[model samples]
Target: MNAKYVKRKSYLNFLQRHKDKPIIKVVSGVRRSGKSTLFLLFKQELIDSGVPENHIISVNFENMAFDELRDPQKLYRYLKKMTTEESMYYIFLDEIQHVQEFERVVDSLFLENNVDLYITGSNAYFLSGEIATLLSGRYVELAMLPLSFQEYVNWHKQNDRYKTDEAFFNDYLKSSFPYALFTDNDQELLEYLQGLYSTVVLNDIITRLSVQDVQVLEKVLATLFSTIGSLVNTNKLTNTLKSAGAAISNKTVEKYIAGILDSLIMYRAERYDIHGRQLLNSQEKYYVVDIGLRQLILRDHREDFGHIVENIVYLELLRRYQKVYVGKTKKYEVDFVAINDQQEITYYQVALTALDEQVLTRELRSLQSIDDQYPKYLLTLDQLNKTANYDGIKKMNVIDWLLQA
Candidate 1:
């Protein structure tokens, strides 16, 4: 099947906002989360907005065509030839971490008067290490994520004749990466996801870090994936792996977990301070990049639908660029503490089904515990009842809420 065009309106807006800025627009996300595709889309937007095609210089370092330009000096000279002083030049470099000494080339291009730069990479090391120091205060990092449920819905609406139901569509959430939505064949899609996972493990994590103990890293990742939406600690994970005969140390486990975070395969949500209103240091929760990969790794029982709901909620908050955390009050605990630049906070509670009386109370109690007047919401699969308010908190069907945003 031909690749379907799923419009990523949010990312398009981001590009349009930062088009003429001198700072580099750095896009970072997990592997195959549509970073390259979004870059192409932004390029097309620029062309449509009246920029000449020749003024836009694009390069994918992963492509064999640029293999010889691995050295920073050669890359600098190549770009110098393409750019001119007369007009504004837009330069795009995709998967730029594949090139050796890439920071030097980026730094040089940024110094050029006529260039507006954009780059994409799959690893956090691209931001955390020398590149960050080299371009300090001169870049804006746009963290990308897999398709939101709404994006997935719109994508399906474009081609498929059969309209997918909520329960059926929930299966698509099982796979966290957006590219998997392109194909209809289940086996082919699974195989493709598996291959992408392996590539990320090998290329983005192990090879980039020069990690020696692949077994220990794999064990840590498996443990994290299996325990999604639960509080986790390095010491506990280290002990568990030791019991399983992995012989991994706590310090190494911490490092490996950080590596995983850097690769964007998993995200850590720290505990939020309720009274002092700061991020707490202990017992942070981790969520996987894609739910489907989580299912693939833990093939036994799929009984943790509540945790899956939590996972989906986490991704939605991330899609909005909200800083999310576990919120604890005196009497209860909120599932997520979403905060934006305005210091505005929203309390969210997620449950698979709030139909049961006990389930509804348990989810609502957390939001009630917070004495503040911030917006409180309980998101679930309870769609038959569409009451806007429940005990002062907003009651929203998770699917409806996702589609709305």
Candidate 2:
């Protein structure tokens, strides 16, 4: 049974390395992005490492079985009562945002000498400023995401055989969520994704925010999702929605985007001025957290292949824990400015394909403009033979980049 679980090696390695430290491990991500599954795998790891079953307590707040403990006070009391005799207890709370004032409970648990706390929140509500104030300098926030293309491929290879490159391309477009590897029927997968999208919109956004104009919000979403990887702020978005028959103010649009952001449904990438070494004030790009969710809501996946590649590149940078930004050169734009843990900066230009000589040169121009010798790359759908260096910038196949650890 444990073998059936796909261990997210890098993420789990992070958790395992930080094991039993005096900090709460908080895994936050979009709904159904596999937070609970990761926690289960970690819990199983604990069991296999010879931890007594009685010493570990795991609860999912969404489960009806845990309904009685949804209250913060009751949950606190239940855990307090269960481990009265334990010396070191590992407590895992899944979807902890569903619990009222959960940060208070987490704070209380942190006060205990014996408790090692881990909680998962599907929305940004879990990591609000108040929680940071409550447990300052003491919690590990692991921003999890849906499975990567490599993870999906490995999962499928374990269960069935396939042509690697073909499978990778299929995953790049259709298999948007982690659960995609668990099912073969496309329609059923879309249905599951749609249901999850609704849940994210309703619970994490509308219901949680007490939004009245659901249609306006939907229109706002339509505007955003339709233009992923492009630049459009609240003002432009508001105007677009008004033209679409939903009259909403820029202020309202701002609020809606904030709410959308808080739900983890979409992420904003601010612009970095490569010349000035500062973040620009406007024209930030927005990326939907998962391609599957976009496919589920928009009903067409084939049209936006270029932006789709950009979006995939964005998430891959995030998965690798790189600090990413849209790079602004003097006269051209770099697709991404990725700074790793070592503070090394690199510029990347992402495109669907640069098979044509003109297109290849166009893709390389921005990186070519940067005179400093930081690593610059041109990434596309071109195979190895098709990829070649231009003026010291490395040309790589996007699929090859995604497969790398």
Candidate 3:
């Protein structure tokens, strides 16, 4: 089945805003989160705006045909030779981590006046170590993710039945990877997720980290995946695995978790002390990159739908904010504290349902504890009043909040 690509306007807008600027455009995301497709869409937009096709030089290192070009010198020569015209040449390199010393190629291209460089990678570490120091402030990174709930809803509103809850259920159950849209059935989707998960683990994690014990790594992943939205520390995780029959050290567990985070399979949110105005170096929470992948890894995770909803809310915050943290007051905890590019802050509390008076009060207490007057929100699945305000705090349906642009 041919997959219809939804125009990811947010990411596309980022590219359009940075078009032909002196800075390099770097797209980073988990594998199959539509990095290549985003580049393709932006390239098409350039062509539509009258940029000649021959001025675009695109290469995916994953393709065997580009095997020889994996050498930094050959790749540099090829790109240099491609820029024959006096106008700008748009160059996109996909999965560039496959190339050794890719920073050199990227650094060399940045010096050319007529070259506009854009690159994509599945591993976050590719931007660390050498490339980071080399490119310092020379490039801007547009971190990408799989489709948001709004994206899912917009894409399926006309093609399928648009029951709000059902649509969300389908998106949550099937998978959020862009390619999952073309899958015909549950079995096909599961197989696709399995392959995607294996690729991330085998290629991005195990092989990249030189980890030898696959079973231990699987255990670490299972533990982390099942505990999304909960505080985790390496020592505790090591103890838990030891009791469960896996013999692993705390350092090893730490290394494996670092590998997992670097691979973009999961994200860590540090605790921020709201009153102290500083980050607390205590237990940090981990959220999986995609909820559907969580489901696949922990089949029995249906029991914690509340945390699942929290996980979804966290991912949405990530897409909307520059920095997200688990907010901590002197006496209470807020679900999320989002800070934007303008340095504005927002506090959020997520719950599966706040219909019960007790649950509602409990959820509100955290946001109320924050003394600052920054915008505060309480997001829940409850739809009774749909929208309401509590002491200047806005309470709205999580689904509705997600759909907001």
Please tell me which predicted candidate would have the highest lDDT against the true structure. 3
> All candidates' TM-scores?
0.95, 0.96, 0.97
Can you tell me which runs of candidate 2 are displaced by over 4 Å? none
**Clash totals in order:** 2, 0, 0
Ranking by lDDT: 3, 2, 1
- In angstroms, the error of model 1 at 249 is 0.6
lDDT (Cα, tens digit) per residue for candidate 1, span 1-405: 124656788987888889888888899999889898887777888888899999999888889999878777888889999996668999999999878888888888888889999999998887776668878998888889888887887777666644646854666666747767656776777788789889989987888678898988888999998888888977888899999999778778888888889889889999887877887777889998888888767777388888987898898998874588888776666889998878798888988788788977788888887888988898888876655587689888887888886
lDDT of each: 0.83, 0.85, 0.89
Clashing pairs in 1: 174-292, 176-290
**Residue 336 displacement (Å), model 2:** 0.3
Poorest 10 consecutive residues of model 1 by lDDT? 161-170
Best by the TM-score measure:
3
Better of 1 and 2 by TM-score: 2
Question: What tens-digit string does per-residue lDDT give for candidate 3 at 266-385?
Answer: 999999999988999889999999888988888876898888889889988999999999989989888898999999999999888888889889999998888889999999878697
